[model samples]
Target: MIEVAAAIIENEQGEILIARRKKDKSQGGLWEFPGGKLEPDESVEACLKRELREEMNIEIQPYESFGVNEHDYGSVHIRLFAYKATFVRGEIVLVDHDRVEWVRPKALKAYEFAPADVKFVELLERE
Candidate 1:
């Protein structure tokens, strides 16, 4: 399984941060929670912090484990860990994704998110 760590970053206005995948990427043109694959010897927290920095150029203080989901992309299987986090510092500078947005949970369904993220979006809507 490919281990992945992502954050559910909530802004002061109570909107969640979502990143848009580049058209050439695997899950091209889909929106997703910002994160990356976990590396060897790295804890989920460390992986999250590192990914946020590398992918978005921002820092966050991860709070609790929000949820987990798994997805099968034919040849690849991914196990995703979601965490609730608060933005700590830096302006978001997108490096991997093409766009980013702060959206309300109710509006989540309006965007085409990765399959793995759909469950989390449901969880958010239910809560």
Candidate 2:
């Protein structure tokens, strides 16, 4: 199983951050949360902190653990830990995505989200 962290990256305006995948990626052009796989020896919170820095150049105050969802992506099992992050610092950097967006929960459906991320959006909307 692979461990993943997802950021419900909320901006000061109460919008959530979503990233657009590059056209050549596995889930190309699909919108999803910004985070990466966890390395061994790091906690979920720490993994989130590191991933936010690496993927978006931002420091995140991972104030809460929202939820965890386990899913099957064909051959691989995915364990996704989602977090609510308050943006701490730095400019928005796009090191791995084709585009990024800060959008309201209701507007989430406008984008073609990854399968796992679609589940996450439902959870967000229900909140």
Query: Which candidate gets the maximum lDDT versus the true structure?
Result: 1
| Error at 81, model 1, angstroms | 0.4
Q: Which candidate is the best by TM-score?
A: 1
For candidate 1, the clash count comes to: 0
lDDT scores for all predictions? 0.91, 0.86
> After aligning candidate 1 to the native by TM-score, how far in Å is the CA of 15 from where it should be?
0.7
At residue 37, give the lDDT of candidate 1: 94
Report the poorest 10 consecutive residues by lDDT, candidate 2: 118-127
How many clashing residue pairs appear in each of the predictions shown?
0, 0
Model 2 C-alpha lDDT versus the unseen true structure: 0.86
Off by over 4 Å in 2: none
